[model samples]
Target: STYRLLSLVLVEGARVQPHYIADTSRRSTLLELRTMHHIRQAVAALSPEGAARIAPTRIVSVHDIAPAPEITARRNRLTRRAYLGGQYDWLARFAAQFDIPALELCIHVDDKAHAFISEHVEQVEGEYWQLRKELVDTDLSLFRYFRFPVLHLTKLEMDRLARQHGFHEIMQKTWFCHSPWRGRPCGICNPCVYTAEEGMAHRLRPLARLSYTLLPVLSVVREARRFVRRVVKR
Candidate 1:
């Protein structure tokens, strides 16, 4: 979605970065690199006129582990809040060093951002959940150089935009798995679930699709567990 959004804009060149979780499988990372390589090759194969329309892009790696040790002090355990904070911190430094005017973040709009935060506040875990009791705000407006280009669009909306802009093929090359099994996406992961729920199951492998088929049953089991936990707490 972010890539598709960038394709519509006028930019000299693009530097793609992929963030990695220390403990999870590196399948997504590998896929990202491959996809970028494929894209560059496709661009190179294009006619000069066609290639000129697309921005030259390259992959750049940054220090992704423990960008915020205070919150992600536990080894291989980084919360979403801390992860994002770390990313913003790095972008701030990068922008200052290069004298860049502004930085655009391709984060899509989460309709349930507030709801998710509220629901997970009492829970022990969640990537996007707040680790501190006093901080309930989920807004990422503190970064002055950060601009959210797709802040108003949902994942489904982004899909529509991609199709409308003829970048759906490029978008299809994107990877979204956090925990992959044998180089394939684990369909039960948040990204897989969202992809299935957002009407993109055709992209998932057959086994992942099978797992997605059982998602309703799994959802029921989760709700039951949550209900029992709430009852026991009361």
Candidate 2:
């Protein structure tokens, strides 16, 4: 249902619509489509060829739901409440097009992410926490329209359950990319940076892993160089 966490906690026999918005990004590639393609392939391969357990991932067009592409996160960026609301509302309409009961959004909240959000509490003006919180609150309207509840599951818990089911390595097979080079992570983009910080090293390559692992040192060095320039100017 998302380009984020790979949902391995699929309910057996439940009609799950693993849908994605086939919206083109600034990078010129439909990264969601590519990622979901890999996910669908992995999901199908996991449970056996042509498994009836999980439904195929759906690719709903952005133009089909929203009036224009300007409302997307890529264009509008989730700064304003109205922009964020528009984004979620578009998704709600997309879901409403289907006769499904409700949408289940898989949210992966880790200690690192929680700490990051807490640290940025003072900078709530267009921060990820603020915008995400506002958009998440719209789940109520989504549920009311669909007449069902949207489930938010943690990645840690899902991993635990995956281990129980003997398929804890599905994430390694999943894909998350906004800007990819030769189908590999660019290792410097926002999604790649976050992917590194979130401790998915096993899924990423050496360069991507190093980009995140060395980010702190790089930041400090950059600041030190800037200070030296300032002193020289003085």
Candidate 3:
């Protein structure tokens, strides 16, 4: 399945341009194609296991040249759609062209942002539950428009799923790796700090621990940088 999917991508590249094809003898995975210079290098890195699975093929570099203002505007709109959960259609189209099944690997759960805020707010203030409820409703609405099969799992549930998918040990070890502190999770931010703490408190899964460790620090740094830039602009 992986080989066929890659072949189709390569074929698409051929249709786009003839000279785009480069030998991919070293590349291990399709992700290496993201870098133009690494195309051949990545193809060279492919393991025997990967080679036996897929055919050795030349890859093409699909470069986007600067266009006129109207073309740029259209490209921006298309890019936005591609980012905001609209890439599924693109994938479907690609799959149809290659006669392959377009499988969606969905990871659905509660919004970490709301969950984190709820934990920090005073329970007596009644804002925590209200915000949490709103997030739940928002997530429900978001899922209604999702066309793929979504595996709705809590932080803990996701761990179980990861283990089932043969990444149990990796998931467990990486959980705490993202923490701001060595042993304790940061109790702020949406994904890393907040989700980490909650998952740990509830023994959600070892896989989810790292986000608590690392994400808060990164988010804080980014927010601070943004604030500084805004103040400078003012």
Q: Which one is best on TM-score?
A: 2
Model 1 alpha-carbon drift over 4 Å, by segment: 9-25, 43-100, 111-143, 215-234
**Predicted structure 1: clash tally:** 0
For residue 112, give model 2's deviation from the true position in Å: 11
> Looking at model 3, which ten-residue stretch has the lowest summed lDDT?
11-20
- Identify the runs in model 2 with alpha carbons over 4 angstroms from their true place: 1-11, 26-45, 68-90, 96-100, 110-153, 214-234
Report clashes for each candidate as comma-separated counts.
0, 0, 23
> Using alpha carbons, what is the TM-score of model 1?
0.56
For residues 1-234, could you state the per-residue lDDT of candidate 2 as single tens digits?
232223323433344556666666446256555555665667667765334545666677677873424333332443342323234556656656664454543324542223222322222233112323343343233322322111223445555666675556655555566677767776666666756565555666887777767777888999999999999999
Instruction: Give the per-residue lDDT of model 1 (tens digit) for 59-154.
Output: 334543324432233212323433333344455444444444434545555533332233323222321222234432323222333444454467
The residue-level lDDT of candidate 2 at 122 comes to: 24
**What lDDT does each candidate get?**
0.52, 0.50, 0.35
Question: Per-residue alpha-carbon lDDT of model 3 for 87-130, expressed as tens digits?
Answer: 22333233333333332223334433222233322232321112
The per-residue C-alpha lDDT of model 1 at residue 89 equals 47
Better of 2 and 3 by TM-score: 2
The candidate maximizing lDDT is 1
| Clashing residue pairs found in predicted model 2 | none
